[model samples]
Target chain A: MEYPSRLIENAVGEISKLPGIGKKTALRLVLHLLKEPEGTTAELTEALTELRTKIKYCKDCHNISDDEVCNICASHRRDRSIICVVEDTRDVLAIENTAQYTGLYHILGGVISPIEGIGPSELNIDQLLQRIENNKNEVKEVIFALSPTMEGDTTAFYLTKKLRQFGVKISTIARGIPIGGELEYTDEITLGRSILSRTAYQQD
Target chain B: MEYPSRLIENAVGEISKLPGIGKKTALRLVLHLLKEPEGTTAELTEALTELRTKIKYCKDCHNISDDEVCNICASHRRDRSIICVVEDTRDVLAIENTAQYTGLYHILGGVISPIEGIGPSELNIDQLLQRIENNKNEVKEVIFALSPTMEGDTTAFYLTKKLRQFGVKISTIARGIPIGGELEYTDEITLGRSILSRTAYQQD
Candidate 1:
């Protein structure tokens, strides 16, 4: 489409480079920025620039952070003996929102996907092993909280083999139907797994 | 959700201020930007800043432009005798994409919406009147291409009253069931209007 102004066309082109956003949505957003106060655009650009240039990854867990170490790793209340391994920072946020896990996190940055040329070395696997080796007694359990995808499984298997010599107890998060999901509508694999891993009923 | 870094939180907060974007989506976009080369963030921010700071509106049509007059207004191929009045620049783009209309356009900036505190005086109504008055002999028709909404109708009614003395022909884009829309699923008001304004069937 022909844009009336080169500036608008340039803005839309840059904004649409983001995933899930198209030319139309980008145009809408650009126009919205134009309609808003000039300060809005300045604030947005400044924040994004700061985030991209200054943001740091936790030295311990590889999670996005503002300092050498993340809050979860620094917090005294968190269980240092246990660490939940996941793909990216977003997963860390998702699990954190549950409030069910108080253990530390190990963000792998991404899983081992041969199709995408991401190997174990590309992730934070070495740091994880080194972290466990240095604090062998302090770190007792390592939980795999990655997605139930082929890449996730491959990464977990590879890590399990490498970490076996460390003598740390390794486990994975359960695979089953979601809490509010209906059994009839659930996929066969999830439904079957839920049944196979059924737990004893307990009285509230 | 708890963000690990203040910089990330600030970026997400600012990005989510846009329409249709939420905290999660904003975080996803922010993280994507972080993963990309630093220059990507710099380019995007620069484009948005330049767009907001330097973009101008066409003097003749009030459409977004880089100069005093837009390309459409400057084009000699366009029919100067006809002007299509729209709410904003997006509508002009939409109409232009169809490649059917060759007339010029006059953007009103926005339609009359009393609930939102928008009035005729707040829009480009005066400029539109002056434009028509200055080119009284050259301009023969003024077409209303605003959306079919209460505010759109109100704006049209007001403009019709004001432009009655200009002796120029006034028309509006046709309103009917959309092409490929099923009659059974068509809304009542649109169906009623389509039937009321039924025309003789024409063969392709």
Candidate 2:
């Protein structure tokens, strides 16, 4: 169990700090790296160092970008008038991967969580409102694509109330049982769908 | 599919660089970090930044140390005469965890692998030799605690030959079929043991 020296221990210490990596796993990785060609550790080290230095957030949609603006926001092919508001940048990427939605996105950064002391002021809601007001001549629809959690719901309701004043159409992603779901195991998605689709909730 | 912003992607990229971490696992880790208080990312960033800065190799045995020498090398309680040579710092920790041995250590940095262009010259063999010569009056046993691999065996043999001139006792860890008896499923350990334990090489 004795290591060859301090160099390996330093490497293991750095590696163990990574997510899901315990000391044992870190030791395994360090051993594997030690067994590789001399330049392997240098490559991994360089990649890690550059990861933080070279990458940045897109100023517009907030997606990861090597440049000031992310590819999705800069692409003219996407619909500039419709904005899909999501909880995190990951959601933006997920929607983009489907190749079905061609609209620009607005990353809310996170949903409202009262328990965590996160309020409307802490979010990017002000910028969202300004974006809608500024783009009124061209913009049409705003989609709330946040998650189904309580915080997500709170943010959706808050956004709905605020954006109604902007005179723009707002719609939340439909909630209901997911596709290929069994009725017995159907989650609150089904229950929520039934509520949203109720006759009284519909416009007269 | 979309991330909330470039921050998540940047974090994910950083996480994925660690050994054994894939894109999905990286995402999970990033999400875990994101869910924490705002200071969590700062802590992770701080840990990574200080990883290389704070830790140093032990001057004598080459184990990791916060000071000039590692605890094991500086301690008066350890058997300084008995030096156990291992492949890396992780082995040092592993052996220490067992608490069976109280001797000093010599880290080889790595085993000799000709296929990988690593020769004895690339290892810390010279340091070990120098240590033995310098402390001729104090040194006694030098155990070769190498892995049971081809490269490990070759290095052990090579070290044994080189150290034979110095009149030091050199021995490798025991190798044999394991405790469990399943001839069909027996692994290399058992197989190697059965071969090594053979009466003698018989003439054909």
Candidate 3:
């Protein structure tokens, strides 16, 4: 549908480009922004602009960072020798929110998904390998803390085989159906638990 | 818990201010933005910044416009004598999308809500009366195309009482429960229809 004004249309277009925001929701958001003082809208715009300009991939862990190294990688108190491998930054944040882990992290940037044309070459796996090679003697464990998706499993297995030569300990999160989750909506947790609880991976 | 980086935190904080966007969704959106090239991010930032610099309210109708007067108000094809009152620019866009109305619009900026501390003084209602008085007999019907809510009703009633002194025709949109709506979620649309269809309000 045609917009009454160019400004409204432009605002909605920009908002709709955000993840999970459709045109209707974009329109609603733009209208809401219109009501607030001009400075508020300016502040949001300025922040987004600055976000891109100031942020970069941390050289040490590949997680988002304002400095050369991310906070997790730079912290002296964390277990530097034990790195938790995650598929993305959100997983890092999720684990951090629990305050249960105090280890360094290695962001894979993404998992191996052949369907999406993302293969081993596209990932920073070589950098990870180099890191492992350099720290082989000092490092104790390398936790495969990626999600329990098929791609996640594939990447984990691939890493385990590749790193077996380096003689580092590897582990994954214990899986089971989540509390308060329905059987149908039970994700990798339930599926992985069912598989693990079996004698071994066998024919259906 | 502390964020992996300050950049992620800043982006999430700004995005969370948007309507219906929580910190989680803001993170998702920020991640999406990160995947894009610098040009795309810059374009959106520039557009948002310029929106505030460019847009202004039309002096005659109070609708948002890039110029001294809005397109709808300035256009010769539109019926200048008829004015449609709406809550905001979004309503104007919705009605314009229908392509049914060819009249000018008066944006009240917002409706009357005592709890929100908004009243007639906060709105452009005085400018509306001034518009009618300035034009006198040239103005014909004033359509109240506001939302069918308690605040909307209060604003309409208040306007009707005030406009009665000016001897101008006033009308409201026909009401019924919306099409494709479940009965359980239906509000007082049926009640509104009964009241609107009442014969006493009719001039004939």
Candidate 4:
């Protein structure tokens, strides 16, 4: 489509690059910004620029942070001995939102996906191993909380193989039907796994 | 949700202010941008800032433009006598994509909507009228291509009252069931209107 202005075209082009945002939605967002006060756009520009320029990852966990170490890693209340390994910062946020997991995180940045040419060496696997080796006694357990996907499982398997000699207790998150999920609606493989991995119940 | 870093929080807050973007979606987008090359965010920032700071409106039609007069209004190939009036620049672009009309555009900026506290004076209605009055007999037709909503109809009615003295032909785009639209799913009002406004078939 022919844009009346090059400025608008450029803004739309940049905005539409975002995931799940189409050309139409991008145009709507850009126009919404145009309609608001000039300060709004300025603030957005500042926020994005500062986020990219000033943003850093926690040295220990590879999570996005504003400082040398993230707040989660630095917090005294968190369980440093138990680290939940995951894909990216979003997973960290997701797990944090649950409020059930108090353990520190190990963001791999991404999974080991051969299709995408991503491997163990490209991720923060070495740092994680170093973290465990450095605090062998302090870090007692390493938990694999990655997604239930081929890539996630592959990454977890690779990590497990590397971590076998560390002598720490290695575990993975459960692969059962989700809470409030109906047995009938569950996918065949998940339902099958949920049944096969069922724990023995002891009556109260 | 608890953000690990203040910078990520700030960026998410600013991004979520955009229309149709919720906090969760905002976080996802921010994380996506963070995962991409740093230059991507920098480019978006630069584009948004430049667009807001440097974008101009056409003198003849209040459409967003790089210069004083937009390409559509200034182009010699366009039918200067016919002016298609729309609610916003998006509408102009939508119509332009159809490649059916070659007329100059008169962007109203928005329709008359009292619920949102928007009125005729807030729009470029006066400028449109002034353009017609100034052009006089040179401009022969005024087309109302705004959305077929109550506000659009009200705005068109008001413009027709003001444009009556100019002795120019006025028209509106046809409103009916959309092409390939299922009759059973069409809303009663639109279906009725489609039947009422049925045109004679000029078959080959």
Q: List, for all models, the DockQ compared with the true complex.
A: 0.92, 0.16, 0.64, 0.87
Off by over 4 Å in 4: B182-184, B201-204
Question: Candidate 1 chain B: worst 10 consecutive residues by lDDT?
Answer: B195-204
Model 1: per-residue lDDT, tens digit, A53-166? Answer: 899999999999989999999999999999899999999989999999999999999999999999888999999999998888999999999999898999999999999998
User: Who wins the lDDT comparison?
Assistant: 1
Query: Residues B1-204, candidate 3, lDDT per residue (tens digit)?
Result: 467667678778988998789998888888888878877788787777777677788999898887888888889999888889999887888899888999989999999999999999999999999999998888898999998789999999999998998888999987765578666676676856655685565677
How many collisions per candidate? 0, 37, 0, 0
In order, what lDDT does every prediction score? 0.95, 0.74, 0.84, 0.91
Q: Could you give the candidate ranking by TM-score, starting with the highest? A: 1, 4, 3, 2
- How much of the true A–B contact set does each candidate keep? 0.99, 0.17, 0.67, 0.96
Model 3, position A115, has a per-residue lDDT of 100
Candidate with better TM-score, 1 vs 3: 1
Model 1 interface DockQ: 0.92
Which has the better TM-score: candidate 2, or candidate 3? 3
Clashing pairs in 4: none
Model 4 scores a C-alpha lDDT of 0.91
Decoy 1 TM-score against native: 0.96
lDDT of 4 by residue, B50-140 (tens): 9999989899999999999888888899998999999998999889989999999998989999999989899998898899989997899
Task: Using DockQ, give the best candidate's number.
Answer: 1
Error of 3 at B77 (Å): 1.8
Q: What is the Cα-based lDDT of residue B105 in candidate 4?
A: 91
Interface RMSD (Å), every candidate: 0.5, 6.2, 1.6, 0.9
